[model samples]
Target: MIGLVLAAGAGRRLRPYTDTLPKALVPIDAETTVLDLTLANYAEVGITEVAIVVGYAAETVASRVKGFEERYGVHLELVHNDKAETWNNAYSLWCARDLLTNGVMLANGDTVHPASVQHTLLDARGDGRQIVLALDTVKKLADEEMKVIWSESAGIERITKLMDPASATGEYIGVTLIEPTAAADLTDALRVTWERDPHLYYEDGYQVLVDKGFRIDVAPIGTVDWVEIDNHDDLDRAREIVCPS
Candidate 1:
């Protein structure tokens, strides 16, 4: 399986920085960025071939491609999402549909997490769980968080941003292992989501797969610190969780 990162969206909430660079390029530490941490984690887990979907300020990430590979010791291939600024990540993910065939350890470029979370999903895949998700069951959910409810059997039966935070079992941490067999379905579902509405998130793709009878299991990274950088407040939290200086 290959590693994938969706680093497209123009994070308007995080302005100034995103004005010149994508959110993934915004530094959490002095020099290290969210994308840096993500590539490091992927490399740490022995995932060398990585695909990054880029759009807004895509040039910035393109310029750093060789540097990122040299530093992380991983081969990076960039996938362009032309609609990144006009549409949500459902399309950004669909843009990588051609590159993500051999299964993928997909992560949102805006999230900061250690290698352990990557290990958790990889381990689950190793155990034969085809569709795997890295969940943060320990963290308290907010309305904006992508929330998930427990399945009757196992994993997540439903995941969405519109779910009531009170009923959510946990947050879908934006890390997923889509095995090769499931990749086709995921691609199809992503297309449906984007065609139906350009504003839908990629998580809606998972929901479509569920409606078509796919089982997605979860691997909870219990209490381990991770942050999804959104606004200025989330950036501060990311610095605290990752840099900790």
Candidate 2:
């Protein structure tokens, strides 16, 4: 399976560090940045063909990726998202539609989790579902993170609630395994939504799919070591999880 890393965001939440460097390139541990750590994680699972969708500070990201490829002997494909500023992550996914046709492992660039990924892939492979989104049961659900409510028996995941920390049933772990057929449908839905409502976030597309009666299975990565680095505090927490010095 091919890997798609959505690294196109400007990371306004992580500014002024991101003012000069992209969020993906921000140093996390002693030497590895978020992007490098993520790539290394993928490499560990034998996912060598990687496509990173880049935006704000795309050149710097590209340069860093090149260095990583040379050092790790991995193939990294860099795709640019020109409309990254105006569009949401759906646009970044759309940019790599061609590569994601069969079955692609989609990951958020800022997420650092290597262990859960293998379990996620196994879950996706065992079930013949169209989309499989990784989820975790966190003690404190933050308001900024996406929340999911799913049917345990049917494995039907629905974004029934948005950024409601109190109403959240579970936390989305920023990793998804998607079938090409469902991804194509999602792409079409995303395009329609963008044309109708340009300000909609990517989770809106998940809502659309759920509303359309599509079965999106939830692969629970229960209590796994995972981190989504959105702000400075999150980065610190991730460092503790990944480096632990």
Candidate 3:
């Protein structure tokens, strides 16, 4: 298995920070960037080979790819997502389908969280289960959050933002483990999602698999500190929790 990061979208809401650089390159601290921390986490988990899907301000990430690889002691693969500016992550992820066949520790570039989130997903892997998502059952869900649905019989039946916040089991923390067993199905699902609607998230691919009788399990990272940096407030929250007091 290897590390895979989807850092393609133009986070327009972030303004100046994303004006020149992609959101992944946005600094979380004086020195570390969102991509930096992601690579560090992958390295910590012993994943030495990492693939990053880049678009939007692709040059910025491309220029620094070598440096990031050296800094994290990991081999890097840069996948290009041409439709990043106009399409949602479903297409961005589909663009990586050819390269990520050996299973993947998939992460969204815009999210910031401790390495434990990755650890949880990796550790939660089971012999028969092919997909395991890092879920935050403790976090209070808002309408914008990608919520999960699970029951005693169905582990994770669905994952989407359209679900009512009051009934959601947890928030899908934008981190997932795709074992080799599920790669082909996930690729097909992603392709179908992009073909159907370019504005759909890769999470829609997960739901596709779930609806097809694929048992997507959840690893509840209880009370974990994490943030998805979508807007200015999220950036502040990331700094507060990701940086030491």
- Give the alpha carbon lDDT tens digit for every residue of 38-130 in model 2: 777677777788899998889888777668997656788998889877777777777787886857788888898875565566555655688
Ranking by TM-score: 3, 1, 2
* Per-candidate count of clashing residue pairs (backbone under 3 Å): 0, 0, 0
Candidate 3 residue 19 Cα shift, in angstroms, is 0.9
Give per-residue CA lDDT, model 1, range 156-221, as digits (tens).
678998888999989988899888877788899999999999999999988898878777788889
Report clash pairs, candidate 2: none
User: How close is every model to the real structure, measured as TM-score?
Assistant: 0.97, 0.91, 0.97
C-alpha positional error of residue 42 in candidate 3 after TM-score superposition, expressed in Å:
0.4
Stretches of candidate 1 off by over 4 Å are 126-128, 152-154
Best candidate (score: TM-score): 3
Clashes of 3: 0
Error (Å) of candidate 2 at residue 182 is 1.7
Of 1 and 2, the candidate ahead on TM-score is 1
